[model samples]
Target chain A: MPTHRIDLSIAGLRLALETEAPPADLGVDERYGAFLADGDGEPDIRVVCRFGEPVAPEGKPDYTAEDIWSMYAGADGSWTAVITYPSPDDAPRPPALLSIDAKWRNAVLTEKRSPGLWQSVITAGAAELLIRTRLVLHDSLVMHGAALQVGDAAVILTGHSGAGKSTQAMLWQEAVGARPLCDDRAAIRADAGRRLVYGTPWAGTAGIAVNACAPLAAIIVLEQHTENELTPLTAAEALPMLLARSFLPYWDAALVGAAMGAALNILQGVPVYRLRCLPEAAAAEMVCARLGLR
Target chain B: MIRKDGFVVRDVGGSAVIVPTGARVLDLNGLVVLNDTGRLVWDALSAERSEDELVQCLTDRYDVSPDQARADVDELLQQFADLGIIQYAGQPI
Candidate 1:
């Protein structure tokens, strides 16, 4: 029942992980694992990882060590962690730490070796880090691309990197006294059967960030065309397209299906439009007209 | 009138939802309910049967006269037209 703890805060949300004693039958002398639980102490997620002597990919044991981290999401939204050690001789080092700020999110993995060697460890641990981050961000505000406030409502502008997502957000803010939620990454949550999209600290090219949430009014897919036009997309057409642009990586099929189902529920209720136009205020006007805001 | 061709209906979420091969989800409540007669009418409509043809088919299959079958088919067709489930193609069957 020995345990270890790790706490994280992102976009005004706090999450913690509790590690318990590793199982006996896993065949490792050093057995330790952790369960990621919310503040209520109910085990929502679990991570059980063990490390053994560092064995090089080449059939030889190199006291130079490595670690592998695996994660699974429980039915109740908790995560079970499994960390494998290279060998029994390799002592367990401190768990990796990650911090998200206004500029960027950083992950620090500590081992017995120098900082240069941590890169591989960090790469190996990326899956776990991504899962934990996603779990933390779940049920909060999330925008399709980035979100910006227009008048009283928050507008989410989603498109490819060069599709003018940031540019449109800037134009709306400058023309209508609007503010940015986040230019790069938008936080999302579900409330009262509606998905509320919010702005995050991660801003892409616009470098605009403000913490805010709004009931998603519409989702516009951007396309740079000569003529300014807004066309509506049916739920069938929007479902697959939105799934492709979804932020979460496809690690588990069931999780992906659930996420897609949630998205379909949103699309069925919210309006989805295809905005084909040049980057200018005119495009915003077209979008507004489609949303019946104008 | 309910133009039987160029349209299809399927049950979705316990409702008879119409989906044209290249169109959006359209409701066919007036033309078809969940009852046996409504389903039979919908099945006949799928084959592009004319009103007279549908009446004859239904009269032969069910214990109904030609006149009653014709009246039911005509009423259902008008209801389908009002609900946008089908349109008048402006041609003779």
Candidate 2:
């Protein structure tokens, strides 16, 4: 049979997978039923999950594959599912892979196993997702939960979950006719001696994804209150809040420190404010006034 | 031996710095640096647990002997006192 290959590009990482055996250095752990390997002695941790024939009894739950899906975790501490499709030459069956709840750091991998090779393909896809979204705390591209825009300049709204991030984006569109750069996740990168925030495909509850890039003007942390108001957050207050909300693994001390430093860099270069307000168009007015925007 | 709210805490460079929060950065002598295990112990210490109760809790959570736990607790308390991270609320243990 000919080999089938798939190449997936996600985030900023490139992943290539082929229908061939994996390298020998990979350690196989039967307990987790996966293969683990050290990718170039870096922090790139790789785990390969493979599946075989269903061994469950009739009317009983398929314990073999389903048990693995229960263990997968994403780079941002979010849970993700793995999808697999069976080979064409084999018996007509759907992809035989287990969905595990697991998380990975910086890693790139491709694997091929026996019988149910589709399982390896599924694992490869998951690895691509991990590499793309896993924020390299030291990198110039900083990820934050905010909507960014490019008009006179770039504007960002930083807020916690349920702190009206989506609502604020809507207001920008409705009132000022601003195009959203990103509704939930904004990737801030320095380009041409200017810091710019670009929108990614990842959308929060707002379901808004904008691929626009804009020079960052101001960063506003959203605060819910009874009235519309804007206040300046000192470096001390803002640093911890930003670090806590940052989407990175807290266990990695070096990464956490690097992320803090990057956040401080952003705070120092840009004007950051605590925008407290009710969910209304007036909140946009308050923000515009603070930014000196017309 | 770190007291809750007794130690001023701040997140310094991403790591948690349990100092007197308002204390100046130059006053390094007044702060107790906590390792991973020490941070775990600090998190577990509360007014709700008596000294004996704390020792028991430590023994349950960590793989340490009772005598070792007692010694560690005593040493940590002493360190906290020296750094002013905690103070004796009432009589000494």
Candidate 3:
């Protein structure tokens, strides 16, 4: 069968998805429309999709995630990721499997059944895991945060779930008409001596994702409060908080080390703040005023 | 004794921070900051070393007396044990 390939440029990384199925049959979600790339370039990561009975790795898994995903360390120093979906019908089926080599440059994704393009490509979490793991090698990471383009720069607001990341973004959009780059995951990397944040397709609940990037102005760690307050945090003080909110590849020690290095680089370049604020426009106004955006 | 599989120590903003990797992230959810002496002991534990050897490592590098080094090593090792950062071999090395 002829190989059908779709290339994507996400967060400045090129990913090529090759499958035996025809391109039209690949049910890629519309959310990925903005990230499609020209196929003339060399991809940083390439994932080949096929239909088969996915095999589990030998021995006990090295790591398990939320009872559905598992990671196994291969004897050749590679890693394999298996993602199982919860079926409402209580029927057992083959899980999705993705095996990447030591460098994570190439991968093979296998499934017993083809649900759709999005399910095989994105929903399986195989491509995302590869993207995140490969990102650390290039000194980049994805943080669980929302970012907005406020006057030619990106301001990232990060926190744990339900810490008002989206609420604050809504306030900023309402107050200053700031365009949200992404409402859930923000990809940050250094480019030409300037720290930049890019939007990813997985935009969480706000359902906003833009294929754009802006120089990072600052990073604000959000906390809910009755009144608006912003406090400066040193890089050392901010490292742990940022790491906690990042989608780190915790299954591998070398990847984690690279991620830590990338995070440290970001900390050294960008200023960090802790914002204790209410869910209102006034809080947004204070942040804009303090940042000299208004 | 050997250091845990995924606990890595790095220098962040002039401070030594110990970060966990792999499954260790579940056990230690936060970073561990180490003082100069604590870092010295941690580096010494890269190879299997006894508590006495760790004390000797500190005393050799710093101007502290043997008794003070031993006390510091004891405290540091206890903290490492409590945090599961180090594993013992049952027999003293």
Candidate 4:
């Protein structure tokens, strides 16, 4: 079988992909465009993708099977993730697995199962899970939100689904000429005295992914409102809201502390705000003006 | 009988939050919040202390009477048990 060497450089971390099939065969292009990189010296993380779907088990569970799922844990210093899928009969089955070294620098994709678009799906799934695990170790985290660069500062808008985070990201582009870093997920890292936000290739339906980054200036929790309003969030209120919006390492018992420690560092370093506004140009203008971005 | 693994208390800024990890991540519904009193109780239970020991800790740490400390400990432990954060010894689990 033919294979392709795909290199992805998001922020400064690298992912070397050795796929049995080209990711292009599964339509992975522009979304991963910003992350395209030359296969440099030894990628930080290696993903060896093999072709195949995971096999489902043949029987139902002894007690209940309504909530079949995956989990990750850190034993001693090693990290492993077990991903179990739901079955129609709700039968229990063996799970696909992934593991990382004690240093959180290396990981192996032990198993993957995709019906057809195996390359793109498996690559994205593995990258998302593994990258998240690694990022938390270094005082950084990823969130289900939109990030935009207004002038020199990185502003993030995030909330639960239906909160118009993407809409506001688009609005900022149209109204203030702010560049969209990512309209789906943004990676925030706390390094030295600076908090930085970077774009990822995994754009939610919005299809906005820029591999750019900027100093994280403020965090905005999106709240739909009739009029534009930007309220402040003290550290007390900001910590929980940020955690609620972040991609936490809930499975890695050891990494939970890591993620929390990073979140606290972020909360202390940057100011968080709650943005309540309409999904319109005026709302974007108002937010920019409030932040002195205009 | 509380799990020696799967759960932990993390400090986000100065606030303490309880998060599940490892196998417990399969049951990721939400996290637990700890106030000062709850933190005291949690610290006491960290080493698998019995109910009587927990009641004593609360009484010694705070000005509450033994009876009140026992009542409060029961309330919090019951919540932890219900949330699968801890379990009673010899219980079916």
**Between candidates 1 and 2, the TM-score winner:** 2
Count of clashes, each model: 32, 15, 1, 1
Alpha-carbon DockQ of candidate 4: 0.45
- Compute the lDDT for candidate 2: 0.52
Please state the interface RMSD for every predicted structure, separated by commas: 17.6, 13.9, 1.7, 4.8
- For model 2, residues A118-221, the per-residue Cα lDDT tens digits are 23434323442344324453244445666555356768787777788778878877876667766666766545556667665556666555545677887788
CAPRI accuracy category, model 2:
incorrect
lDDT tens digits by residue: candidate 1, B13-79: 3334332321111232212333345566766666556778878778878999888888888877776
Clashes of 4: 1
The global Cα lDDT (0 to 1) of model 3 is 0.82
Candidate 4, residue A229: CA error in Å? Answer: 3.7
The runs of at least 3 residues in candidate 4 whose Cα sits more than 4 Å from the true structure, single-residue gaps closed, are A1-4, A19-31, A51-99, A110-122, A278-282, B1-4, B12-14, B26-28, B48-52, B65-71
lDDT of 1 by residue, A164-263 (tens): 7767777776655556677776665666777676655445666655555776777778888888888888765665556445543232333343455556
| Candidate 3 residue-pair clash tally | 1
**1 versus 3: better lDDT goes to:** 3
Q: What is candidate 2's TM-score against the reference?
A: 0.51
- As a TM-score, model 1 comes out at 0.49
How accurate locally is residue A39 in candidate 2, as Cα lDDT from 0 to 100? 30
Candidate 2 share of real interface contacts: 0.00
Which numbered prediction scores highest in DockQ against the true structure?
A: 3
